[model samples]
Target: MRSVYMQSLAYVDANRIYSRIMELGEIGRTKQSGVQRLALSKEDKEAQILVTKWMEEAGLTVSHDHFGNLIGRKEGEKPHLPIVMIGSHIDSVRNGGKFDGIIGVLGGIEIAQFIYSNNISHAHTLEVIAFCEEEGSQFNDGLFGSRGMVGKATEEDFQKKNDQQVTRFDALKNFGSEIDPARYKESVRKEEEIKIYLEMHIEQGPYLDVNSHPVGIVNGIAGLSWYTIMIEGTPGHAGTVPMNLRNDPMIGAAKVIQEINEICSSQPDQQTVGTVGIIQAFPGGSNIIPNAVQFSLDLRDINLTRKNRIFAEIEERLQAICQENGLSYTIKTNIELDPVACSEEIIDVFTSIGKKLDMDIPIMVSGAGHDAMLMSEITDIGMIFVRCKKGISHQPEESATKEDIAMGTEIMLQAVLQYI
Candidate 1:
């Protein structure tokens, strides 16, 4: 294939990208054609193996860090200079869409492949990463790999459990990971080591599609928080226990979950949103009053102060509701991230490149958390959003046109060229 450039404008073979996407999507495919490739699972490992092979085919040296992050690097003339990094996560949520995070990884690899095959020269080392556990679908603390890379993930974070009652620590161990609490820093990248982070992803929202734009420049990412709610009560026979005399933890959990919806909907900021991902009741029998209940809450907002303030009210409401139900509960915060803005300088670069390519690049906001969010801790970050069909994501129906994928990939390539 020829280099994807016409007089310095970015271009690439979208068929190659789409073909690889379909190949990878075959792994962990659900009956509905969605993906069930949770982090640290066999499927996730299988994905790593396949993508690693592709990385090698692109003539990049590949390495896996202690945190399970896959890094593919090609040294530049000035190898000592901070690297230009590109990528997104490969892990998927249960029954997730095929194009959500897959395009970014494949697109990044295509860029490296182009650089290698065309013998493009640059001054800074180029790296492409496949970050692990960004979905947090299994472990519940998302961005585990990126967090670890920046020294933000802790031993406790690795020890988190999934709905199957499997601790992530044990899962990682079973998946062939040798994690030592003391050695976590080994995966960390110092601020000076990273010049900037670039990610290409499906918009996961309707903005670009509805606006009839093929690609978007992300200006900011919404702040998000994940919490686990554990409620305790006395278990009793459903038939024998009178409603007034029984302490039902399930009842308490219901109230708190409902209040989350109520509070988020009532918030003056329409962007504030909350969702319950998983809920489990102990002694889950039709005839038994639940003695324990555990559930997770996902809350997001672009406004930090307002989100925090709303969370406080929700906390008090949880306490009051639990007391009313004659129950006790604890809400443990799993992860909390403040809103992060993309680098303005990089945004300008993208805008300028878009103009040069004669492509309309819409500026937008990302409501989802990404590896790019955590990478912002160590360096400037930028993102390219491809328009997905109907702006749908995280579902089997999630999709993006090849044209949009090509547009987004070109933006990523141009950004890399500018940085290098």
Candidate 2:
């Protein structure tokens, strides 16, 4: 079938989009003005229900899978053609800002509403999805909904437990999802059915704001490796133990963290980063020497080879530090994701549209992972980023101006029109 040419242009209602964003924020609103709609929780379910309602109001047919991924589809002029999927997740990290995942879903809905109201028919069907559990804040399973949609999820994933000691199976039950394994397979869409996937999100970093760019075109998503390290040592009285003689595991942990920072910084490419986000020293007391220390290591880089090499060096240096400190250590790797590159064709489309619209659109790599990375496994994917204040995200202070969001939505609308 031949692709549909652009017949007319449509505009997005920025006020409506912003209003929906604020409405979704209220479901899991935090005292700090952030959101805490963890996946499969009551807040998340409410957010999903509200979004589904909006999707229906937009004149789209809504459906959900066993994994609870909500999909709203608007038929195209050529129903047999593949679909153009546009959306992001609704779930948020603990105390996450309002725009992280909310914009993509709502932005897609606004675009759909525009098209429906204008009676502009495209060549392929348009689908907006509010994915479940993209933050992994609740179950430690990032991209849970996207993975299931792409056939990358397993039964074991459903059986995983959360902090409250509740399994995903039970959580889904509580959220009122139908848990039939046989029918769950229907949730996975065939790759051939989807022509392209588009997502819009906040820059979540300082790049766009510092450079004074209103929108960012993502070229790639960085790969990530997560490791938990535990050090064992003898606990003793802090006052009685000599500094040189004390076998404190905290010392070993400190040394490892310092070396990791140094190693990552030493790399020629400054894109590689290593962070020790979580740390715990057991037998905690001012007078007691800590006997055990546990810390989490997060490594990210667009280059997989360099990322792995850096991880290897960190492990080696950590082992040496433990040996010298007379401490035994164990390392456990929890998650590893390879980098995903965006579609060059889609990038070119966005660039061409930006130039035509007289906008400054710079292409950049994503430091944080998103559902777009998972969607890349099945179809060509592209991402548009709106500048956030100080590049702050995953917190209450995260924000983007109405003008920036409107500019982003305009670009996205034009790009979809041109591509479809």
Could you tell me every candidate's TM-score relative to the true structure? 0.94, 0.92
Best by TM-score: 1
What is the C-alpha lDDT profile of model 1 across 1-420, one tens digit per residue? 333343575458889899889888999999999988998888988998899899999989998777778889999789889999998988898999888888989999998988888888888899999987899888767898899999898778867788888887677656644444346678799999999999999999888888899889999999999998899999999999888898899888888988999999997748898999889999799999988999998999999999999899999999998888788988888899999999999999899889988876888888999999999999999999998889889999999988789888887887787787
Candidate 2: where is the Cα deviation over 4 Å?
A: 1-10, 179-183, 235-245, 282-291
- Candidate 1 lDDT at 267 equals 75
Clashing pairs in 2: 205-391
| All-Cα superposition RMSD per candidate | 2.5, 2.5
Q: Give a tens-digit lDDT track for model 2, residues 1-420.
A: 323345333377878899888888899999998999999888988888899899998888997777778889999878888899998999999988899988999999988887787677687899998887888888875888888888888888888899889988778666754545446678788889999999999999999999999999999999987788999999999889899998999989999999999999998868999999789989788788898999988899999998988888998998899889899999987677899999999999889878777776899999998889889889999999999999999999999987788888887887787666
* Residue 161, model 1, lDDT: 81
